[model samples]
Target: MGGDCESNVENIIEVKNLKKTYISRGHVTEALRGISFAVKKGEIFGILGVNGAGKSTTLNITIGLLTPSSGTVRIFGKNFFQHESELKNQMNIATAYADLAGNLTVYRNLKIYALMYNVPNYKKKIADLLESFGISHLADKWVGDLSAGEKTRVNLCKSLINDPELLLLDEPTASLDPSIASHVRRLILKLQKDRNMTVVFTSHNMPEVEEMCDRVALLHKGKVYMVDTPDSLVKIHTAPDLEEVFIRLAKGELEE
Candidate 1:
């Protein structure tokens, strides 16, 4: 499924008949079974599914962290595999599971990534990012010594080091308290709007998905179960909210 074609919106990411299979110990697991979707530029697209439904597998493939068993991934209208390095330079990902160096100070950690990205005037970029995320005071502190919320802020700051056109976030607020999570959500929204950046994220929080996503793809048993806006899915499924839609999908109560 793809975004509105009538509007002629440009697709920043297009996944076509994507499939990924793993063979281990004479056992086979099909992580993705011909799932296809397109994410429009300048919009937040969410991938929602229960565990083992292939959410993470799909994201990893799109980010070039994993290869597909079959099918294709096209970023910016070009074959991703043909220009992975160049494409990756325009993308960055932030995840609590993908931690920064624990022994390094926040500033140092960011500097290392900035250097890797070959960011010009990296010091200024690092300083500006820390300030923007309200983590400037934590810059000198060791990443290992920071609180969970603080670390998340720093991770977000580092993600922006390259001024990426596309930002991928995996459970960006997974372990934070409500207040901190709310703050992080606001900051992400602000940055996405201010920069007009494309975002693809995976989150189990239905409310968060509904609040932030312009469109969502619901995966079930390694296939795209449905694709639509949260509100539209609710109405189309005759459900009360996105959470109910998710539940129905997970339980196989909804049909394609």
Candidate 2:
């Protein structure tokens, strides 16, 4: 009930009892403490948390980039770690944390990824993505030389080249200007509408979450403070917007 479970297998991402901890120089830090949530099909599920709220940790484990300290993360009903190739085929991750090969041109970068995924008609697919994002002009330029905004757009294109069933985005539009950010948001919403893609995105921008997500979970101190529809949560919490609720949760005003 907390996360719209029991709705249908229409649910694309299912996470249960997930936990992660870091031990650096014998100092134990619990990053994610028993987190649980699920994103249904065709929804832009938002995970809102401040810095070090374990958003990146949760994403890393879910995408199998980092081994979990404990618990499970499933994409499209299969565990990511157990079914690497298949889960990867079903999912794609995009974040600023990812490294782009400095030597590769944007076109080369995507071409390599497309080939890796064995995406059919790779050349045509690449063309389509470039045109979709209006990045064709930068195709031949080295990825390292691109502006941050261009690189961000390219990163999105890289994740989307395979047309994944589940897309993970972390602060996707963080560095872009307002107009570009708006365009990026619209593109994401369009992807959700047109492809019915299940998305789990972490963002600090409340209005963006309110506009893009059907549901959101506010995380703080390695715990999910609440999960609900933006409208419903706003009404129940008596807040004018998500930002206010985020403050309440982040400040430890909510119950554990």
Candidate 3:
């Protein structure tokens, strides 16, 4: 196996033989079954799978929010568990499920996170994010008053407040209108290129995955079925697009 080979020395993320099991109410659930993958630095990698396929489970493990029953997650050449605190300082996570303080104003909420991250020139940064996201008018508005789309923008802004080297996103555009979702996609691309940030995200939106991701991992029932570029997967599966590729994989029709 290519375990910890120098070939992966340049990778920003290296997960090998990862496994997670949960025991609940006298029942056992195996969320991951020895999945392995590596993400390169400055690359936008995607984790694609249907619900309960272990995409979220894998992401949670990568971000150190959950522990694995076996295997290793290495970030920047260091074991994740051993270097979690230090590494997390350079990483951030954003989800469509907003984690903001509902009672606080948008500005207040972002300000608190900015302070936590010790962002430089935070006021200017906050103003820029508000303007960029077209949420300047909502700055003083209570977060609870914002719409789903608006809250998503706010959550995105908070994720970037730290200017993290690595960013994790969970269904960022879920439930968003096409226009707003398009804007968010463009913004993410710009951020990735401008800052050379490493991004790993989970999405069921195949078109979005095809357009934005440099590489994708297809997971099914807690195992990675395949990992490749969108075009490559399409070519391999002889499908029109990623959606079809996913469908075939789900049906157990794709062969080695």
Point to the candidate with the largest TM-score: 2
Give a tens-digit lDDT track for model 3, residues 185-227: 9999999999999999888899999999999988888888888
The residue-by-residue lDDT of candidate 2 on 4-51, one tens digit each, is 344246677777777888899999999988788888889899998889
What CA root-mean-square deviation does each model show from the true structure? 2.0, 1.6, 2.0
Clashing pairs in 2: none
Each candidate's number of clashing pairs is 0, 0, 0
Tens digit of per-residue lDDT, candidate 1, span 173-217: 887788878888888899899999999988989999999999999
* TM-scores of all candidate predictions against the true structure: 0.94, 0.95, 0.94
Q: Which is the better candidate, 2 or 3, if ranked by TM-score?
A: 2
Poorly placed runs, candidate 2 (over 4 Å) = 1-8
Evaluate residue 86 in candidate 2 and report its C-alpha lDDT on the 0 to 100 scale: 76
Off by over 4 Å in 1: 1-9
lDDT of 1 at 236: 90
Local distance difference test scores for all models: 0.88, 0.84, 0.88
Clashing pairs in 3: none
